[model samples]
Target: MERGEKIVKRIDTAKEAKQNPSYFEALVELLFQLADDDFIISFRGSEWLGLAPHIEEDVALSSITQNTMGHASLYYHLLEDLDIGNADKLAHERQAVERRNASYFERKNGEGSYLQEPYYDWALTVVRQFLFETMKKVKLETIINSSYQPLADIANKVLMEQPYHLAHWRMWLKQLLGSTEEAQNKVQFQLEAAWPACADIIGLGPKAFELEKHHLIAGEDYLRKQWLKELEQSLSLPSSLFVDNHPARGRYGEHTADLDQALSTLSEVYNSDQKAVW
Candidate 1:
């Protein structure tokens, strides 16, 4: 039998059929968004695996990358039970248009390719991840109280393991932002560059209305407002520094060239033999 056929047969099993259907749809969409975002970004993170500026920091950072990928796998497996697709195929083979992830997560690490002249901006990475994880933590907190039992259960599980991701990024952000002239300059530079795209990650895209209305997740404004509050309090930065308008919303499927490049790189292996079992 063809690999796709085998995957289909496996997905058609009892566990797939046993879910509460209504909750299943909502939960699946949430899972896809969560999983795809983490998967793509973590892949980007892995590209920096050996290229990090410091060896000790490299080891510590890889742990977060692996954890995020692991979380993505959990969501993908959950999706498999819902008959979406095989976990590996969904993660590795999908086109950018088919991917439900945010553009922020898909953006490049820096100016050069990971394989060459990897002048990666560690400060940008630190700032973007710290900001992103802060929002994710806030949202996950709310998700833990969701009306959908499955989501709430998963959210609880994710939260249990999330502090490490948060702490790691937060430490990087604080240290860089609070450090010497060069470090602070680099961090500030990246933070400003990231300011415009930061909104896209939190927008929740086309399904925002439905997700919130159905209680699958919280509203954008609420999450944004709360996230800003927490960030301001934590960083003690001037509140006036943040910009209100995020020009492009990734939640709406709007993306940049970086996303396209990233999609091509990540999907290259899976798309090669989508029909094969391996």
Candidate 2:
């Protein structure tokens, strides 16, 4: 269903990468940024497994979570193809300081655990997932013509499935916001909380110029504008959505204890014995 697939400029190979060090450096950085964001968010989604408001929602959410994690794996494998390391290790064995996901993704899905005292907020999930899925589509579109042909191919493959994810959350956001005052208030609170760090989520981290310099991806400013425009058209956003602070800047290796806690849980099975075959 992918239409008008562009002819991508594939990199010759890591062995033939004769460019200066910064080119590969930017490539790896971008890969980490893409992989880590999806990884953490999917982990968050896993936490919501079987804990959605109802069974049908739970099943649908699980499917979306699996798709997201699958996307992350595709990125990690891309890194592995670069001989960065094993994809499993990159996903599970890294220190929090080495990750590149935005901090908001690692935040708890409201308070309490899924099995006990499951006080997870559906409104927050609706808003956050809607915003993230929209942003992810924008990023993927920018990468569809990526200079790295392998990644461009993956982007095209992923673009086929991404619309469903965006639609699921967008429907949740619209239905909830229009339904009840309480639901709208809850979503509004999430929107306010998300606004401050919204800039970081859309940022290309510290190496934006280098990535664009090598024709790796779209310009960061252009990306930010596109993302913001899409968000404004979908949601009732403030006229001036200024980012005064970052809850955590994962791109710069800056994160919160939330990420630390998340890593421990996500890596529990893998870290039990890194050598064991799963």
Candidate 3:
């Protein structure tokens, strides 16, 4: 396949996808990236369980987290269908170095543990979720036409509920950014902090050539361009807010200690009974 050519054959089943080594490898890499990104971020969202600043937000965040986790499960199940591994094990057993989630999503919620004197940063949460959901919407839109039918199907299903999730965070971001000077400063600080680390979030990883050639999804350039266009239309962010530096490329199996801690907590119960069914 050429760089700009559309894939004519639709792979409707895992069996068909696995028939080609190159396609299979690219597909698995893409699935892991999608699945881990959602899985880790949802775990971070789950950390905000009862500490969302208000009762209503508490419930809303929880529901969104559940939905996001369900999205991750769907991706993992597709991986399972490909004979990669058990879905629960894939979610719980992966090490930090094995994870493909952007390191920005794995940063500790704040300076404290959720069970302790939790000092979570709501500004960071709002900014991160808003930015992530925006990029997610762009990526999903690109992949909805994926040559692999099952993956495209999952993208369509996720798109149905993703708008609500994006709206919730966008509302929070807009309100905070437009409120008092202190709130505006907090949001701005997070935006500045997150700007440089976002390169990896919109990236398609080291397998970019294979992913694009196989028509698994559009190229990284297309994703980044569309994401920026969407952000510009939706928010009055400065052009300086966007940078091309990647502090960490989780897609290439690079991560931070924050991911290790998150994994330990996430897999604690499942680790206790490895043989037990989830």
Candidate 4:
């Protein structure tokens, strides 16, 4: 054993987290990012619910939306255990600038409202979800081995339902890409749009060094490599994929106005008289 070396202890429960303030804060921070990302993307999914091209796909995709929101709730509850706040309040009450989700998850679905004058594109939906699920697979794989025991357990539970989501989107993308030239081009265009945005998805936020230093999670470099390996094997990358181009990195509290609109819609019911029983 080397002199002056410190041993990192595993956090087996919420009480252990509080005993180590740094560990608690890091766990809470990472959980906030995970919860917020899932919440926003699932909200986008709900927006596309009735507007899908095919009835069967619409129904199937709706299930995924429900599952995503469920995952968000799981993460939010972990934060609740940390004394951050109740899960519902954490999910619905936070201002946009306080969110820690990647900006990639908050982008608008398309040109108009889901209920009227709709111009939704299935290609973007498929690309976005597939890409996110792939990245999520990598993230969860690392988090399953996290020092925080509760989070590791949550990752195991999440992985059970998450693979179906990845597979569904993967199937959509391959079929669309293998179809007509028009379909291929449409899908390809959306792929390019998301390519540069992968930076935000791969990042561990401003506290990357600290998170890795504490053995809370793998370093951003390791996570990115894992994600890129999966991505390259599945979908051929555009040149832009390598660029660290993020319009806004939400992990650092930067968010677009799109997030403002989304928060308004998703929390409308909950925010209406915060005490009413539904």
Please report, in order, the local distance difference test score of every candidate based on alpha carbons.
0.73, 0.84, 0.90, 0.86
| Top-down TM-score ranking | 3, 4, 2, 1
Against the true structure, whose lDDT is highest? 3
The 10 consecutive residues of candidate 1 with the worst lDDT sum are 5-14
Pick the winner on lDDT between candidates 2 and 3: 3
Better of 1 and 3 by TM-score: 3
Total backbone collisions for each predicted model: 1, 0, 0, 0
Tens-place lDDT per residue, model 3, 1-278, is 68995546789999999999999999999999999999999999999998999999999999999999999999999999999999998999877888888889999989989888999999999988988999899989978989899999999999999999999998898899789999999988988888887678888788899998988898888887888887775566666543767667898898888999999999889988999876
Model 2 residue runs over 4 Å out of place are 1-9, 242-244, 276-278
Q: What range of 10 consecutive residues in model 2 has the weakest lDDT sum?
A: 9-18
Of 1 and 2, the candidate ranking higher by lDDT: 2
Tell me the alpha-carbon RMSD of every candidate. 8.5, 3.4, 2.4, 2.8
Q: What is residue 16's positional error in candidate 2, in angstroms?
A: 3.2
Error of 3 at 60 (Å): 0.6
Q: Give the TM-score of candidate 1.
A: 0.82
Q: How far is 265's C-alpha from truth in model 2 (Å)? A: 0.4
- The C-alpha local distance difference test score for the whole of candidate 2 amounts to 0.84
Model 3 alpha-carbon miss at residue 42, Å:
0.4
